[model samples]
Target: MPATTSLQSLHVMVWTALMASLIAVGSFLSIPLGPVPFSMQPLFIMLAGFLLGWPHGMIAVLLFVAAGSIGLPVFAGGKSGLAVLFGPTGGYLIGFVLAAGAIGLLTQARKTARTPSQTPSWALGLLAGLLGLALLYACGLLNLVRVLDIGWNKALTIGFLPFILQDLVKLVMAVATWRIMHGRGLLPR
Candidate 1:
């Protein structure tokens, strides 16, 4: 390859590494709010999507999952491997990629559609993030239902109800972080 191509490849690799490391570090910063811990993963997930945009953000999240699957201590409590990926929380783990992509696409649209005052309010951004979070839970709850042989209502009650408050906090945190990063010019517009 040409030197320019090599450099571009290096840049891509570096961003990939940064995204994976951020997710892993975010996983460690948790509060153990319930059966599901309150973690900074959502914040980083949104950050990944917004800063890196859809394609790179998705790639980054996928790389993080792959690392965890290969048995790196990239998850909460330093756990990893295929079993953890297949565990109850596994679907949520896998859902992060989609969540990031969705958020990026939606956020980009919101930004393009309105002026600052007309743009989505902070609440709206938080709500959007929550929707992304819900996507993660939807996958998780469905997987739980399938694996645990439970009905949707019961599975949602058991697998999702408890996490609502924590996820709300996460959504708020992610939105706040997005604003902060935008202000600092750390995140792209």
Candidate 2:
């Protein structure tokens, strides 16, 4: 691969910052249902992957986490600081990074990731989005069990079950939005 020109590098940096800001903003729209909150963060997390791919997507998520860790009002319900990172739902925050990376990696594998204006392939995107949710729920459930010192069954009952329908809706929205943006040549590249 050719080295990135200074201008290209600047674009990447700007896009990363923009996407990170979006992820933080996504958290502001939240509903505290139980151990974890329901937020549009998932949509933007997956969108970070769909838009930036791999390292950029992952870094955008990391930037958001770092902001929240340092007293920024960027977490769910505008909560911030290490208390939130180590809190019961912290695993979900970590999962955001993993899911973004996972989704980006999967999207990149399609070869069209860098060329969003190409023909849309929702199949790969759908698969990646589903796996992203799986990973997020797994991390969330494990953390809930460990932090709360509860059983897996109980953790599932409270932590994972309630968000299924809502998350699925978000996933679908992410895919549809990706398609619309891709068709419009609006995805970051």
Q: Relative to the true structure, how large is the alpha-carbon lDDT of every model?
A: 0.74, 0.87
Q: On residues 1-189, what C-alpha lDDT tens digit does candidate 1 reach at each position?
A: 699888877876687679779999988887664335656786777777765666777788888888989989888767789887887677788778888888777777677666654434686577667767878888878777766677889877776777678667767777777776666655433
lDDT of 1 at 48: 75
RMSD of 2: 2.3
* 1-189: candidate 2 lDDT, tens digit per residue: 345676677887898999999999989999988778888899999988888888899999999999999999999999999988888988898899999999989887786444645856788788999999888888888888889999989988888788888888999888888878878877677
Instruction: Show where candidate 1 strays beyond 4 Å.
Output: 1-16, 30-38, 111-124
Query: By lDDT, who's the top model here?
Result: 2
Estimate the lDDT of model 2. Answer: 0.87
Q: Count the backbone clashes (under 3 Å) in each candidate.
A: 0, 0
